[model samples]
Target: MTALATAPTARPRPARAWRAVMRLHRPALIFWGFFVSVVSAVLLWAYGPGGNAAAAAWQRPCTVDLCDVGYAVDIYHLAYRFCEALITFLPVLVAVWAGGLLIGRELENGTAELAWSQSVSPARWLATKLAVPAALLTAGTTLLVLLHRLLFDAHQVPKGWNWSDNGTFEANGPIAVAFPLLALALGALSGLIAGRALPGLIAGILATATASTLIGLAGPHLVPWKTSVGDLKEGYAAPSGVIYGREGAVTSTGAHIPDPCTGAGKACPAAHDIVGYYSEYHPSSQFWALQLTQTALILTVAALATAAAFTLLRRRTS
Candidate 1:
């Protein structure tokens, strides 16, 4: 009965799912926007007026070549503080928010059940929750990182704040982005496992802190280091921005020994017949290569956490 050729109505599942996630997490969305705005303003000030002031201060009238270290310290500390916050503490904030506000709170308050009942399966719901926040987090972190790189490269930032610094290393590269995602996934897994907002938040913070410590300790080991062997008299001078690893002395008999006596005055090398000291280091040129490798490792951790989260979600819902 070719009654009437009727087309099937389209169901905007993805769009609706996105909207539902936004609606559910409106407060978090607002808070994230506000935080990003504040950080952006700080970066802008550093890039513009604050930077100009620092330069002007550096140009202080110097007959004997001495300048106002206090003024410079004041100007630089603020910028350093901001960078430090982003690199060191940003992941903790992400984990807390993801655990307490995003997933845990919803599960705690029973809103998750209500959402799931309304045409959203558990997997789709979890995916939307993670996807939306992950996208926002990525955008925000990338912007801050770019601004940091620009400021540092332009020499607007202070000395002693180089790529090798823990805070600077993270804020200057892609690992900055990866760490936060790992935090988010860990937070979600924590929330699902705890099933309580506050406990989830606490667990997430601890997990993120542990991850950061592990990553920092593993930093130099992430890539093969370049080895340099020089006569002990030449001394061990690592390349600028290179992460130095093991140091040892080599004997004239071709035997490698560790940490032999060194210094322009030390006689242990002559007594022991040491020819040279060898040191392992990763040069500044390896920055991006090592950064990407660490990022891959972090993302792998996040992926595993997300998979575990999905499995847990299935068990809970079933």
Candidate 2:
């Protein structure tokens, strides 16, 4: 009884921390909720009424002069493009909020320091900062991704839509979820490094953009490319696929060389000692492999950024 009376009362630190975070970022939280709801509704409409109307428009018998595709196609196209663009660039938006408002503004305005003084270590503060947003971002992005996939898989998208297209590919897989987390991590690191809101916002955006660009460029090479070879008379014989890596003449000695007959209509393959033509590309079957590979890479970078942020925070505080 004496010990109990002398001891300090236990407190729910994590719950308190979570509540504090939510209260501080209430505006951003509201905006995020609204954004997700709007996109989800758009996707649902496209998947149901818009898709049916578009399908019916396509099925209409064509007159010689005009297809008469109707407004449904146009509306569906607009909806799809809007959703794709938003989902694809969701990370940049996250980066902006994170760097500008979440970490940078707090640090810039002495809010973080005040929190640290209130029996909350810098580590715990940072953890709450990252974890709360991370959870929300993950949930929201995952829902968007699933909706996008459902719409795409319904086979009602425009004719030119391909699984390998950048927006479609990212939105259709786990990379959609992974990228925003990366953006959040990057934003946090930028905020810690800059210690100011505006600079942190710019740096975070550039960093996330650069990382995304690099990953996109490397996506084609993430898996083994399928090759199709054909004799000179048959010309190039590659099947339809994404990322046509290489298309050139194949010599009898199995060496690759530039195709001399590419533009010349009557050029002889024999002049270039070309026995056949080869094309290297990624087939549709490689989609999952590529997506998973990119997701792993992005997550790895996010982890590194998170570690760097903690290290920077510790150095500053210590």
- RMSD list, candidates in order: 4.3, 3.5
Cα lDDT tens digits, model 2, 1-318, are 455456677876555888899998999999999999999999999999999999898788989998788898889878987999999889999999889899999999999999999879999999999999999999999999999999999857449688877688889999999999999999999998999999999999999999999988887788888989999778889876476887899988999887878777555777777899999988888889988998999999999999999999999999
- In model 1, where is the ten-residue run with the lowest total lDDT? 67-76
TM-score per model over all chains: 0.87, 0.91
Quick one: best TM-score, which candidate? Answer: 2
Clashes of each: 0, 0
lDDT of 1 by residue, 1-318 (tens): 668979999877555888877887788889878877887777777777877777777666766766554475466658756765755577988999888877888889998998789878999999998999999999988988888787778775356566777687778889888999999999999998888899999999988888878977787798988988888668665666767788888889867687646453577788888888777888788889889988988898899999999999999899
Q: After superposition, how far is residue 23 of candidate 2 from its true place, in Å?
A: 1.0
TM-score of 2: 0.91
